[model samples]
Target: MDDEARRDHRTVGDVDLTTWRTRAGRASASAWVRLGDRFGALPLLLVTLLIGIAIAAVCTWVASEVYDAVREADDVAVLDRPVLDFAMSLRTPGLDTVVTWWTNVAGTVGMPIVAVGFLVGFTIQRRAWTPLVLLVAASAGSLLMTVAGKDLIGRARPPLADAVPPYERSPSFPSGHTLNATVIVGTIVYLLLLRQSRRATRVWTVVLGSVFVVSVGLSRVFLGHHWLTDVLAAWALGLAWLALVITAHRLYLTALRRDGASDIHRPS
Candidate 1:
């Protein structure tokens, strides 16, 4: 036998290490794919459920902390002073106009229009039911969570005297604009990433997604509509929800692949 072949066949205590390792790696990958096909959703469901619980825990902690500080009249620099100062520091005619414009664009009326336009466009292009269902369900769930959070907390908005024009009356624990924008923009970005195989396109899509979410959240604070904690909590909650949506969709794709279904065609 040739030296190379003999070396490949050489056994270490009756086991060929190279061949064993090769088989082991392939077996592992195949098992993973099979698991994804047969039970792909269970893991995602469990992880998402845990994340939802963590989100709830975090929100509860923030609400409790804020409540304590208010009741005790303690000045907590971390929670209160820094963000307020930052907001106040940015006050100016030109920047105020710009930020206000952003808030309006990312707010209730504008974001919905953007989200619906993408939904319709993607649905028409892909001709798939999965994306439609995923978007609708995620949007509805986000709305419900936002409303419930505001109502439950019932925290007052920043003092009217300190706030900018066109003040909001809703609770300020979680920013609805932040939460909605995160879910909508995040999901759209995910869909876009799935459609594109190019590295540059994926990178840009992620960057744009981050910019959209961050901008909306910051605008809420800049306009004095939400506290920093409010925006932070909204981000955490929104991310948790986004993870769930992405996981569910991946599970669907895995199942489709397992069943020998044709892959969903993406526009180049």
Candidate 2:
């Protein structure tokens, strides 16, 4: 046999089912599609990845510019006083008392709870450790990014109309509430989508997750802990990260399907 053929044969060493399953799941998505579908799906995946990347880049740039412009203003009065006034009004012990509770409690504890929930669900259903690994990776990555963002941007929070303590000394360019909301809520939503097959479950999960994210962002502003731009930037960053992760995850799943491990797609 030729040298290339010999090398190929050598690479075909025996592999355990578990190892093979992992190898397939971790295979390059574009390559898998090319091998499986005569390069047709490869082009589509590449195009989709490019489009996603472009959109994320545009959104990130826009968010940065918007936050910078907003931060340049020396006085709050420069913007319509009503905008700030409206946000201030929501801080009263009504209109959204639940929001206050959720925001305060969630910003403190909800993330851990959600993380545990995802872990339990994954263990019970798939019995695979990969989902847990992904969750931990997402959490660590987001936390580091948030700290780095705060340090780099260093935008100040708005002056409180009422007494609202700053729990953390950090920049206000990207709201931590928004960032955490994005990661916690977004991760939960992603995991739920992967696990649940019912259309209603998917719809409701999107609605609930969207509401949670938006509310947390607005709460940060209303509580006088962050500027509107901060929350907006958080959303931009969160969405960008979520898109990247999901796209990568999809590629991984596709590779798994290519292997004999067809059971990977059995309704989560």
Candidate 3:
């Protein structure tokens, strides 16, 4: 063929160049889409898991350091004692009442009710079993971790004289109330934000959850029931666990979507 005719035909060596390029581009796009559909959540899950592990390690280190200090009667423990004494010194009837109220609300009794209510409500509203399972697992796991950590560390609580009413005898390296509250409130906020689309609503949900978690942690110290480090460790540990739960749930949803499950709701 002449040069002009060859150009018009858009062919190279008897192969249609335009057609080949178009097909190649389409194939590349299709492969990318398929890859994304299959494994797009993998990177996020991996990154989250890594971060969770790092945070958990830091918490463990902190708890261990505190445990060592207490065991050896080190300076850390000496300083910690003054903080507890100060916390006790600030106590008044009204302040005690308010702190106790928060402690009660976020403590064993009130937290269980809140968790169960959320579990039942989410299960009923979403008509899904996975959420219920996820929440129950999170709560149970938190309880297990709290108990295990306390038993393992075996750190003593503040002196009875330093504490307010409603004293606890459990070992208190990491505050159970703080850890449990973090997980419970964090999970609830995660689930709520997942279903909510509005930015304002999500922001409010996060804010409220943060306040609840922080208040619960501070109440433990304010009541002289735990040292400041105990609450800090709980925050880190609870956050790590919370991150794993959230990552797992998102992964499950991603798998469901890939498997052609039409009823699965994507997180917002």
How many residue pairs clash (N, CA or C atoms closer than 3 angstroms) in each of the candidate models, in the order given?
0, 0, 0
| Cα lDDT tens digits for candidate 1, 72-113 | 665433675578777888799898888888888778899889
lDDT of 2 by residue, 18-105 (tens): 1223444535443654443564433444444455545544555566666566557744335524555677665656644655666774
- Give the TM-score comparing model 1 with the true structure, all chains together: 0.71
TM-scores for all candidates: the values are: 0.71, 0.68, 0.72
Model 1 Cα shift for residue 33 (angstroms): 11
Best by lDDT: 3
Candidate 1 has which clashing residue pairs, if any? Answer: none
The order of the candidates by lDDT, greatest first, is 3, 1, 2
Clashes of 2: 0
For model 3, residues 185-248, the per-residue Cα lDDT tens digits are 8988877776665778877889999999998998999998998878887898898789777655
Choose 1 or 2, whichever is better by TM-score: 1
Question: How much is the lDDT of residue 208 in candidate 3?
Answer: 92
- Candidate 1 lDDT: 0.67
Error of 2 at 163 (Å): 5.2
